[model samples]
Target: MTDVPGFPPHTQLLAALARLGQATRMDAVRNAGPHNLSPLQADIVGLFRRGAAVLRQSDIVTALASTAPTISDAVRVLRRKGLVDATADLADARARLLVLTPAGEAEAERLTAFSDGLVEAVDTLPEQDLAAILRAGTRLMRELESRNLIPMSRMCPTCRFFVPDAHPGEVRSYHCDFVDAPFGAAELRVTCPDHEVRD
Candidate 1:
């Protein structure tokens, strides 16, 4: 095995752990359902699924650190598939809100099940190893989150803080309730408080 600098002899072990986690998530998405969601789609669904009670398209964009057009396309596709729904914002007459449909919720549950299985499998490992893995994974997540590398866009429609446009043709800023502010069109590089980077 090739040696990585600064990492100990267990580097391969670490790599294997990371790869297994990723593979498990991919497998979950693959086995989830007929949704046939792209990685982006899956991410978006995941966002909405987790935030079924309240979500919005702009929330998804901010979380994903993506452009409005990118999120709009994903939202359109999800809507076409009948996985998500958009409604007028009660407080803001100009904004619409996004949420998952029953079918979408079911699909999201399936994906969550897949993820749960992976966690259970990991739990079956030796206690020491499992503990180490947990600690390492937590550390890794913190480091990545600090770098804004986690996939935030996937949760677009599911984010509790998302606020969509009420009128289809009307252009409006994406409001993130979590951040208590709307994203400015020119502030693409600025990270919001709810930002979650997705790979």
Candidate 2:
């Protein structure tokens, strides 16, 4: 059954995603306002707080799925604000690795706490439902990355937790050792926060 000008499943999904994105941006703006930081600057600081130690400018671009020029602009603004510092890479003199200043580190801690609190406040889903949603979202992201619509990820296929089926007769063709559960190609996660890199 269909109605004229009605949103299909895809349209509804896109609209939901867009609204979430806008809400997230507003949250960032509100949180960063007191520190005189933009959303991008806050994001960069958050990245470092999340264990990204000394990354190149290109790395930030890739992680944020943003353009080099946009990242450069943000980095410049951050440097000017004394929240970030850069030094030439020893191995590649032409390249620079970014690090957070002492002030930046303190701000990062505050921002991380604020972000965690905000997320906790809005998160109403049960654990099982949240896991299901995360799996589905990661699957969609993987599909997009496979189609070259998004950047490649540190995902299941490249993770130590992944175990490919060794026997064609197996009922489940793939497994996630971490979850101890069977997984299908379409259900494989592309951006699991718990992902561990394969040796």
Candidate 3:
């Protein structure tokens, strides 16, 4: 609890994120239920809407930290509901790529509205607060990645194009070689479409 003495900031931040994540999931489920979706189904659809243009069943499992059976069940339900369809993976015939159907696109749009309140709340924060959280959150994600506790993110710092300021004589800049632009600590992309993971 916040009242606890000597509580680590990292622990407190993670706890807060956990609580917020649960609350957001609850809101998503309540709003999506009218459209005949369970919480997991809604989330799977969301991943399809935002994470990638096409995803494998295994990709969902990895992103959600979920089991194969769990993802499989949700995918089945989504397919049956005409929200998604599966096609043979051209790269691997044994695998299937999951794609949202037209109905699924509609559902994604509706879900976006359902979660608009959460977005608005975050957007209402002071600019400094927003910048602080984004920096801290990205650092925490990097730490988690180092410990193998989570999947590697597409954060700017991990990209091949990232050039962190090091020398005192330097301009103290964060540059992206790929874009030929300065990337400030607060303006870094959390999930970028063009992200190429560093080795």
Candidate 4:
């Protein structure tokens, strides 16, 4: 697409905003090491960080606009990794309540700091441009969420498109040697080329 100057109208502006937001998120994952979280896990952690008290699997699925299975799988991984703790919901034995562990809390803090730095950097942009970007980004994100096209489970670390430690808070966007194509929620499988199935 040709780059038209001055916020290429609404649709183009939203698409560009989505791309930028994705890029920023990928960058944050590259910088925060030790544990590599999938986008869904990161979102879950972020929600918890933002005071999502008493979350259920369904809640996460709704928030991330992902399929139930995808959210369940991500939650399982997070639980296995000791990043999240789950308990049977008092009212519904079949439903589990999820919460961040102490370790998860620490990691969330780091992630939040990284995100803050990212936003602060963006804040340096001219006021009008920054406002436009924010508006576009928010609109695009909401639209994607509604469409269930936002791959909550996809993460830079596990995707074939990811380049390990490419740079702090930054990873190549789904262009790594592992997966030839970018990953999405539908591609979540145990035999993915980019990542090994955790036992």
Give the Cα lDDT of each candidate.
0.64, 0.79, 0.80, 0.63
**Which residue pairs in model 4 clash with each other?**
27-169, 27-170, 30-169, 31-169, 160-179, 161-174, 161-175, 161-176
Candidate 4, residue 54: Cα displacement in angstroms equals 2.0
- Higher-ranked by TM-score: 2 or 3: 3
Give me the displacement of residue 97 in model 4, in angstroms.
0.8
Question: How does candidate 4 fare on TM-score?
Answer: 0.59
Could you estimate the TM-score for every candidate? 0.58, 0.74, 0.79, 0.59
lDDT of 2 by residue, 1-199 (tens): 8586877889999899899888788888878755688888888888786646698998888888899999999999889888899998998988899999998888888886556656785577765576567567767876887687876566777689988783356545788888888866546665566678788
**Poorest stretch of ten by lDDT in candidate 1:** 184-193
Which window of ten consecutive residues has the lowest lDDT sum in model 4? 184-193
| Ordered list by TM-score, greatest first | 3, 2, 4, 1
Q: Compose the digit string of candidate 1's lDDT tens values, residues 1-199.
A: 9766776756977688689868866775566469788777777877765544566667888766788899999889989999888999998887679888998788677665555666678668775565455445545655665688774322323345556442345333556566666643222222233545333
lDDT for model 1, please: 0.64
- State how far residue 37 of model 1 sits from its true place (Å): 1.8
TM-score of candidate 1 on Cα atoms, chains taken together: 0.58
Work out candidate 3's RMSD over C-alphas: 3.9
Over 4 Å off in model 1, which ranges?
1-18, 115-124, 151-199
Candidate 3 has which clashing residue pairs, if any? none
The true-versus-predicted C-alpha distance at residue 121 of model 4, in Å, is 4.2
Backbone collision tally, model 4: 8
- Please give, for residues 1-199, the per-residue lDDT of candidate 4 as tens digits: 9776765477776687679778777876676446778766787787776545569998887756778998888889888888899988989989999888998888778766555667687768875575455444444544664576764333333344454344444322223445454332222232232343122
